[model samples]
Target: MITIQYAIIGGTGVYDSGVASIQKTVNTEYGKVEVDIAEVEGTSMVFLARHGKEHGIPPHLINYRANIKALQELGVQHIFATAAVGSLNPDYPTGSLVVLSDFMEMTKQRPLTFFEGGTDDVKHVNMDDPYCGNLRKHLLEAAKLHKIQFKGNAVYLCTEGPRFETEAEIRMMRKWGADVVGMTSVPEVVLAKELGMCYASVGFVVNMATGMESGPIQLESIGDMLARNKEKVNKMFLDIFSKTLDQQNCGCADSIVCL
Candidate 1:
């Protein structure tokens, strides 16, 4: 049985366990999940590729429940997720990084919780502040240490996707106060909270939304941008994990107020 207290869910351009010192697969009730465990700067951490090691899984089809449950079973206490997003707010341009403080779930089909039956029953987890504030503080500090330019806060709009959003959809999301748009942050964030884990997301603005740019969105351009900024993103992750190993002081553990 492998034991780890912290984990990172890699998204988009981050598909492999490059930082992991040990890689293994763990079986859970939901399914068998693969994870990589690594120790950086004396801090042990686990890394899980949210879209699988080859980016084979689509956003709406991700096994969020199995992923989160596998981490919980491994004794994970805090989770840091990385997402590649399209900017909805003009001020947050491509290549910029944003720490997600909240999210709007626009996903239509996906199981959003762990308490669907059994002895655990149903739990109405408090999502008043979905992302962990304490974890966010550490992430911001890490970004500053590395001199990585990042927005302190942003509202993430989680959409159902394998396909990019339409121009009209982007417009409505922006009107709803979403600073960045992505597809996989929904059930992943919520499921973490349900398991008493502190969760925070770091979003890399890979491109402007559908109608935000004058010309059509280019897939090649987005790929090039991510490839260029990949190092900075990796540095930010290292710094955060090296600094935030303890979560005893955070409110994330008490998220479930009712059962």
Candidate 2:
């Protein structure tokens, strides 16, 4: 039982690539999360695929609570998750890598928290800084060291989908100041916060949302885009986890407000 304190949640096409690792199934109250415990640059890290190892799970059905809670059970404190998104902003066109600075929730019918009280006393988690600022800083710094170019920051708009958004939806979301659109990152990010874990995410712009371009959004192209950037993103995450992360006043650990 190794004490792994860092984790990576690979979204879409991102999957396991590290060597010399052991597979372990962490069973939580929510469900069992299968993870890879590996050493990257002499650092032990946990790798979990958000869409399962084979990319079998859909966005709306991902076991977010189980995933986050399993990490908590493993004593993990910091998490870095990747997502494939569609661009609504010209600056973050297809193939761009952007840091998640904020998020606009458009998801519904998903479990958004860990404390669904009745037996346990109810408490609320703060969403002021939805993504961990400290982890984002470390990630950006690590990106520099890895020579990974991030176009800029993005305000991710998460939609409940196994399908892409409509032109009208994209148009409306763009007006809402959303820079990128995706299916994941809402409940997942919030779940981590509720558990007092530092969580930050970066998105790979895989396509232009409907109406952003002239033709239809191509699924084939999205896969190819993710294939190209998967390694770069994973390497950057490993580099970030390779270094010792100290406690910061990010407020992620103090976010739970109880009555």
Top-TM-score structure, candidate number: 2
lDDT of 2 by residue, 157-246 (tens): 999998889999988998899999999999999999998999999999988899999999976777777877888888888888877885
Clashing pairs in 1: none
Per-candidate RMSD vs. true structure? Answer: 1.7, 1.3
Highest lDDT scorer: 2
**Runs off by more than 4 Å, candidate 2:** none
- What local distance difference test score does each model get? 0.84, 0.89
Assess candidate 2 and give its lDDT: 0.89
Q: For model 1, what is the C-alpha lDDT against the true structure?
A: 0.84
- lDDT for residue 213 in candidate 2, whole number 0-100: 95
Instruction: Give a tens-digit lDDT track for model 1, residues 54-91.
Output: 88989999999999999999989988888989898988
